[model samples]
Target: MHSLNDLLESFHLYAECERCQRSMQLSVEKLIARLGNDFPVTDLRPRLRCTGCNIRGQDLRIVFVGPPGKRMVFQYRR
Candidate 1:
């Protein structure tokens, strides 16, 4: 498995609020800008917050959206 830093650096993160089900996409640059370069990846959950519902990071579902694999297209439909 990739390390948190590796995942964050190479992929976009999808954060969803558990309470409101609102979601947002975060880039590595934005995360670094918000949390700083020294922030620990394991500690990210406590630092996230839902903009719509004001939910805490601990209550959010965070998914890593990585690059497309072989035989996969760039577009995502769901």
Candidate 2:
């Protein structure tokens, strides 16, 4: 399984709030600062919150953005 560090280094982070459906893009550097480098990518849903609705982290859905015209190389389930 790929770790957060690996995902961040390889792809972009797309986070959506379950409440208001608000979305945000996060970069590897930013995520590292917020969640540390060793965190697992699959475990990020419970650690994100919607800035608009102020929803808790558990209600967030996280997706990985791969290169242009390419499907995600890594498989992560929500």
Candidate 3:
């Protein structure tokens, strides 16, 4: 069986922000706390019921651009 250490060394998981277009340090932190691992994390596509306060419109556009990279627009209208 592959030990955790060996597996970890082989492939690492990382997360990128779908917003600020950067490494989602904040979200990654939270995900790590909940999942227990944060190496091979996925991009964020956070969605929730329409904010009673209507913070955003029906949907939102989540963008991710880290390290002077291009933007990843996530136009979420849900």
Candidate 4:
């Protein structure tokens, strides 16, 4: 199954350099933990903008899938 974390692994926005293979897979695991194992997130969106710049560059987008194919985005609220 294609997990959100798997998608994140390929994202370059979080990469410090070209040689680094983004291994922040735990973000997916933690998000799942918060949602509970019973709940499964299926998809994630494109890379979002960075804090330093308004550019929608490399970043993680987690799409928490719910019942009946519903989708909820996980992001920090200010």
Candidate 5:
């Protein structure tokens, strides 16, 4: 099980709306400040709401963005 604290360093968290397919990057620092560092990352799914469609369910994506100056590429398929 991964906590929010584990993601703070190298990983980037994103919330994607299942309905409208809207996606947004989340601030891990702000989240840790609010939800505490020990919060389970899996439990975050139900707590998220889509800003675009006002939906209650969200798909969480934990991406490895790597260190500075590293090349990163993301691919999405519908």
Candidate 6:
């Protein structure tokens, strides 16, 4: 069980909708600032909502994207 603090660096959080298959990047810093650093990563499953399909419960993906300027792939959104 990894906490938000554990993945603050060298990682990115993404929430994907099971129904519509839409994925969006979540801000770890914003989450930590709001939910605190000890917030469990697994606990975000039920809290996530899909903007595309308007459904509850999203599949969380923790991807290692490395530090800034290393490997830029997905764009982070709010």
Top candidate when judged by TM-score against the true structure? 5
Q: Choose the strongest candidate by lDDT.
A: 6
- Candidate 5 ranges with C-alpha deviation above 4 Å: 67-78
User: What lDDT score goes with residue 17 in model 6?
Assistant: 88
- Candidate 2 lDDT over 1-78, as tens digits, reads 556678653476777776777878767687778878888876777777778977767443345557557756553545
Of candidate 1, the 10-residue stretch with the lowest lDDT total is: 69-78
In model 6, the runs with Cα more than 4 Å from the true position are 67-78
lDDT of 5: 0.84
lDDT of 6 by residue, 32-69 (tens): 99999999988888999999988888888888777767
Off by over 4 Å in 1: 1-4, 58-78
RMSD in Å for model 6 = 4.5
Pick the winner on lDDT between candidates 5 and 6.
Answer: 6
lDDT of 4 by residue, 51-77 (tens): 444443333433333333444444321
Q: Where in model 2 is the C-alpha error above 4 Å?
A: 58-77
User: Model 5: per-residue lDDT, tens digit, 19-39?
Assistant: 899999999999999999999
Model 1 lDDT tens row, 1-78: 333456453355566676788877766676677767666655676777888877677343334444446232233211
Q: How well is each residue in 1-78 modelled by candidate 3, as lDDT tens digits?
A: 222222232322232433333332234334456545533322223322232342221222323332233333332221
Given candidate 1, what's the lDDT at residue 36?
Answer: 72
TM-score winner, 3 or 5: 5
- The lDDT, on a scale of 0 to 1, for candidate 4 is 0.36
Ranking by TM-score: 5, 6, 2, 1, 4, 3
Q: lDDT of each model, Cα atoms only?
A: 0.57, 0.67, 0.31, 0.36, 0.84, 0.85
